[model samples]
Target: MSQTPLLPSRREFIKQGAAAAATFMIVPRFVLGGKGYTAPSDQLVIAGVGVGGKGESDLASFAKTGKVRIGYLCDVDDRRAAKSRQAFPQAKYYKDWRQLLDKESKNFDAVSVATPDHNHAAVTLAAMQLGKHVYVQKPLTHDLYEARALTEAAKRYPVVTQMGNQGASGDGVRQLQEWYDANLIGKVHTVYCWTDRPVWPQGIPWPTGATSVPPELDWDLWLGTAPFRPYVDKLVPFNWRGWWEYGTGALGDMGCHLLEAPFRVLGLQYASTVQASVGSVYVDEFKRGYFPESCPPSSHVTLTFPATKKNKQEVTVHWMDGGIQPERPEELGPNELFGDGGNGILFVGKKGKMMASTYAANPRLLPLSHNQEVKVKPTLARVPGGAEGHYAQWVEACIAGHGNHTVSAPFETAGPLTEALLMANLAIRGYDLRRPKTTGPGFDYPGRGIELVWDPQQLRVTNFEEVNRFVKRDYRPGWQ
Candidate 1:
């Protein structure tokens, strides 16, 4: 199941598109006039899928490398893609990624996917199968099975791949790792990662008003892989993050950024056991609302990870969202800011505590002044420009070819990281699974009040079979 092959294999596609690729070629940088300029063939040609929102900035960052060419732009909504299309006027445009890959797969050397979490694996897997390097946005995929599949596919395909968790390249995480290594913070047993997210609405009933689909947006194409649903107002652009159909909720939206620090600091992997509790919403005084279609308003999840080489004892990581945060350490001054004031990660070690803001930025020891008392020397080499260099890092790696270069969050790393987070997501969704009671007027919450035991190799919850359906969702017909 981890090695599900896409429709067209690399060898077959290469032979099929050989003729179309041979006739046309872009003018080389040198041909356009400049001494000591690299040839166009040396540049990495990338196809931009989902060229809107973050996709626009991702393309801009990739182009900044001076070693990449945005050769193609693909998006379902032309209005959302207008900025990117105008920025890269010379790039070919397409409404469907399949058509772009079918006709121009041979032309581009790589593909950058910044689509919603649901479409990440679809575009990424196809690109990898075609022998193209890929850079996908964070959280890697929408489900655990997809993350696992992409991981195995990365090994099978000889191409460079990266996840857009730029913080993995930041110096702060490396600093935290060094502190742990030097024993300045003793042995970390617990970590608290919190965020004030879900800025969009959640825990609300789905909108039911009948509305017309916008002319510029291909509603059917946008709903690729996900079940067919009527277009809800404001669901596009951003609000989709709160809905399970299209996004991974708050954890998916910010987990990659917050969790990267601890994963790097302790060399964490799969979680052994997981449990979660979510906040409730009420439609009126009489009853609490039950809107399973949307993610809960907020959640606090606890995951237990077995001991690793970096840490001797097993670790417990807590994920808090929707303005929830752990108690402030008494070592710090009361008025001092806590975790960039809104979003932050706290590592509690036997001897001391260390924390950082989102993206693992601004690392400092507890008590603020204790940072001055610490004397851990820098050991890990830093990425150029830190977090900002993530884009160019992947570009240079693609230029250097698969194993020849290093990417901060390659599938090898991002895959497992994403899987663990998605595993936690199961607990969140499971907490809401409902069934009719044998002889009652209400539903039985069987998935609640339980700790989900995970079998990573099998990719399922050992104790709860019902939640496994979410591990690997079925793609809509014609999509798979």
Candidate 2:
């Protein structure tokens, strides 16, 4: 008690700890399991790109699994990354996703992409090429070409992948599937999905002036693969969804959630044809506003899919957005809610009707009471914890390695789903095509009243050549 020994200073202690960490060897859990098992100590190392907003929440859910370690966090906006950085203080941070993937590819087991729709493909493709598993947010990619590329890449890469449409793991869709398999909805040929989105701006002209870039943001990095543009107020955290350059508008925003149930229940794949009509804004008494860069306030798009084995008859799916909804079914009371109110999906079949809210939640037959009477044994396995389990499902799958287990929204499934949504977008975009008129100060809308015949194999609208440009967009040089 009388003798006290000299101790290293706090800085010295930190230096020693750093040295120890540098030398520590992390044996991957897969090595210990020898294929099918994972030790309790084994953790899935995750590197999150675009760690803000939804991305931030996605990482938190993964960490909640108790089997995941947030090893790296990357985002263009420092302000957006602040919370994640604080939560995972030990995680290395980067402002650019490319640097995170390029340098840390060997350090992490999987990558979670929560970036804007535009960068989703670029980041995910790089991670997959590095032999890392990936979890990308919904609407998978900004462009149809990227979606198809990822779909094909999943087949080639020996890595696990999941798209962030968590609803895919929810029991509601499975319940709908069970009922459909039991013929409760008898060969659903027509489906309607709608949402009241664009709570942000749309169908408006781009802001005329640029604002000083946020000091915490790397504006160039935020743009990623999209074209260069000056920073605009309120575009970073959100509001980007209304811009075509960075988002796919309302469909891209909520299509995955609302359309997933119908896609799964009907076993739908690529669409054979797509058609659309969009609402317009009037600039004045004499002219209708034309803002090709912004998504219209509302739109109605129809996609026809070829018959699958699950149903011999072809299927027609209609998508409505911007407060648009399908006609209410007659089976329900006039006072009853339609598609969980503002957002929902409805399936009309020859025998009966079925509907569900966003994320396919609260699935029910035409007559709500029928849900209590009809019981079909579950044909599909349910994800533990339902939607909340989506994160753990990917973590477990990544640990098991590719092909060892199935994920709910792998690129294979998500790609087709996303392609369908983006295909519908092609029609929406096509509707606004404008051409210079030979006469006075006016323009001609040549794309109006067109049916786009899709050839899934070729990834093109066989009937409409102009709309093909929307099928795939050119990326900014360095980003590509």
**Which has the greatest lDDT?**
1
Q: Rate the local accuracy (lDDT) of all candidates.
A: 0.90, 0.87
* Cα-based RMSD of candidate 1: 3.1
Best-performing candidate as measured by TM-score: 1
**Candidate 1 per-residue lDDT over residues 1-480, each given as its tens digit:** 334552346787576445535533445557566788787776899999999999999999999888889999999999999999999999999999999999998789999999988999999988887778999998899989889888988887778999999999999999999888999889999999999998999999999899999999999999989999988888897888888888999999899999999998999988999999999899999889999889888999999999999898999999999899999999878789899988999999999999999999999998788888768779999999899999889998987767999889999989989987898889999999999999969789998979999998888899988888889888999888
Model 1 — which ten-residue stretch has the worst lDDT? Answer: 17-26
Residue pairs with backbone overlap in model 2: none
Error of 1 at 201 (Å): 1.4
Reference-based TM-score, model 1: 0.94
Residue ranges of candidate 2 with Cα displaced over 4 Å: 1-41, 439-441
